[model samples]
Target: MSATPATPGTPDLPALPVLQADCSNCFALCCVALPFAKSSDFAVNKAAGTPCKNLQQDFRCGIHTRLRDKGFQGCTVFDCFGAGQQVSQVTFGGQDWRGHPGTAGAMYEVFPVMRQLHELLFYVSEALALPAAAPVHADLRRALAETTEWTAADADALTTLDVGALRGRINTLLLRASELARAKAPARKKNHRGADLMGARLAGADLRGAGFRGAYLIAADLSGADLRLADLIGADLRDTDLRGADLRDAIFLTQAQLNAARGDAKTKIPPTLARPAHWSA
Candidate 1:
């Protein structure tokens, strides 16, 4: 498919270095661990833990060049944050899951979890990149280092992790990071607690770790905002623009919240979230 020119009026946000797709070290985990159905995003149906028919022995998508035309648009948007390689090389000691039947199931389980951790790292790293987040740079750096360490752990450690507990701990740091970053931006005088900010323009604004419980943020423009470790419980986020916004370790943010949001190909939702139906439209 031809590249689509970026439309004007859409916020021109800073590109995040942490979210870059690195395929060289990956083992095509998304093509194997995740399942898909024939839809606007995929050309055929696939099952969980089943390798994609188009995935080559070397772990590359055989249909990479024609993914969009073949209805695999979702694959094109997925980024594993280098977890695929980390799992394949470091965690599993360079074992090919397919070749070694003994490690296959463990590899499948670890892939998704590592993807989640790496995705979290992606957001945390992005928050660290923002100049407005200088106040929390030290904490961000610590969190980045800690998360990176987790990413490099052995397969057994990764497999046995209490993922929910790990996520909770990470969330605490992210909230503080967000608050410190948002404090640097020029904004209104009133506190934004529980504010209804649906469809609001918050591009490039520092909103680190803001308490957004039950807030209305439908279609809000959040590109380049620092949302690391923010409390987003019960927030309404329909049609929100989250490209370049760091949502790593954000507390109480759910797939349902994101499903209600109007996101696009560039919007980076949590790994727990399925692609919203409205996105590919």
Candidate 2:
């Protein structure tokens, strides 16, 4: 979710999405820093810090439009959480590591670090916008401010950041915010925190207020599910059927997760999330 670093100081500034990945300015950092095993989702095995074969000289995916057809579907669903452009344009000053070998190592090392920070930014921003989470909004705002500022840090500073510790600190506030938001919807039927609901049939379920943190719902039938205010932090929704599902107020749902799933025009999603391009028309 990186978008050219917002151009530093533009006038008449518009609100930026919590983490928008603007690949127009990215240097294909994800193609290098991330590792992927050959699988049904990815076409080949690639080690971390190694460039992908399909990465073009200009840092764009050579087969961008045919990713799924070429067996690189995982690339289609993976989001760097804006780390790519932040690392390429901001942290490294719009320099391509290919031409400058000195910066290549640092760029790869710092990418995943920025990814973690931006992910926290995403959740913090979402929590701040929830009216039901107003009680913890100020705390979330502070966390968002702190995390947003951290994104501008240099590669060395980012590498040394205690990301796990920061995530722990922020998770406390996010947990409280989730509690306040879910309390508004009293029709919850389950608390499936870290549940393995893979392939389960949950279509049209009364899932309001369900705690789905870390749930593995791969290929689950969740069509038309009532997911309002459900805290879905870290839920794996790959290939899950979300057609007609109402997730307008579902906390922590991300574009990457949505991109990995199946849906249709009938799905009710948050304004913050765009329908994945691959979803059926």
Candidate 3:
């Protein structure tokens, strides 16, 4: 669903089926393996490895349909990138922690690791989809293959893997891929990489080809801003206003970022991403 243009060298990007989370195939790992303190996002404090009060016996959230209405807004924005099912079904052979209490500790420990790996795969897959990044496609393909292999490793192998090193290594190629794609924009671009723009008013600004990598745009007003070709890797978009913004062909923009931001029906997002259900129709 990516909108990247196709060139001679860049083949059509295949769908990344494994990158989409399938909760039915998962054991509700996120509700138990991760901890969240009571805040604007969560209703109560839950310790790591403890099953959430809202979690049901069948491994589904009791308040899933009303997560936001019940003060668990954080859950709506979090995406495991299919790591839960990978850990539960593939890594542990579909073993539920409740049935195998002895594996709970290890499962909890490996979930985060697997989540990080899956996240990287998501980014790498997006990078591969970009036609402008054809120069680095070979490297991106290798990185994707390697990351996919790691995702299939046993729990023991996964827990011991050096994720930081792998992330650092893959990030280099992603950065280059971002640069190549951004260079295609003819206009002069802004470099706001890692800037703390929280709550700033940036409505209607032209931000095409802008580099927002690792930037903090929390609660920033970006309504009607032009974000085509912007590199948004690792950017914090919590509560960012994106109404009427043009994000077609935006690089490195993830569903999690879109879910955290506020938008209206006019917001033009990448074809690959879905409009957040909370957004106004």
Candidate 4:
């Protein structure tokens, strides 16, 4: 799908509402707070806390329209989950890093922290959207609310947080959410342990209550498949397309595993598997 121009003040757009990349209300936070290695995805190596040379006076990407062509595919894929806006508008009260140069370093520190919290909220919100994860919806909702509150905190409070530890706790909750979402799929009748099913097409197939323990499913197309109540312990799920698959009640699905899997809006994952913020139409 082609990218659509965002109408000012229009709530609906092709991209996820919660995942919009708002640079206007930001301090070029991602450019400064995140490090990028020299690769096909980025033009050059940039250290953390250093602003990208391409950042404009207004905190916008100078080559925004040609980021991908300019070897900035990584930048195109990074999403702040609205953290940029929340920090710029709420936490710092619309203050720019330039206006208060003294706070520049501190603002840079807070940006990454806010990004982490916002990313957690993104996953929690996705989990709540699945009707099949009702068993753990309450926990997911509470986590989402708490993470949202953290994103709105003052820069000082956010700068001092043990972000890694907080991320670990949030990851645990997301792991539980994935299990709940997968459990909703229909139960498989038989076990398929350690099967190599790479690139196998199983769209709209019913594998309910089936045991898929330690299966090699690399590049498998399982779109629109019903995987309810299946046991998926230790499965190699890299590059699997899960769009439209019903994974409610699936067991042993981990965040790392889902992270390795490819999915889109139509692909329903456990709340623990936060939607990749960079995904767009």
TM-score of 1: 0.60
Write one digit per residue (lDDT tens) for candidate 1, span 182-204.
56435432245679797899987
Query: After TM-score superposition, what is the CA distance of residue 48 in candidate 4 from its true location, in Å?
Result: 1.6
Query: What does candidate 3 score on TM?
Result: 0.94
Ranking by lDDT: 3, 2, 4, 1
lDDT of each: 0.67, 0.85, 0.90, 0.69
User: After superposition, which runs of candidate 3 have C-alpha atoms over 4 Å from their true positions?
Assistant: 1-17
Q: Candidate 2, residue 77: CA error in Å? A: 0.9
* Candidate 1 minimal-lDDT segment of 10 residues: 1-10
Best by lDDT: 3
Best by TM-score: 3
Compared to the true structure, candidate 4 yields what TM-score? 0.64
Query: How many clashes show up in model 1?
Result: 12
Better of 2 and 3 by lDDT: 3
Q: What is the TM-score of each candidate against the true structure?
A: 0.60, 0.92, 0.94, 0.64
lDDT of each residue in 102-221, candidate 4, tens digit only: 877877788778877866665555555556566666666556656666766788889888889877776666656566555554443666778989999988988886767679998899
Question: Model 1, which residues run further than 4 Å from truth?
Answer: 1-20, 130-138, 189-281
lDDT of 3: 0.90
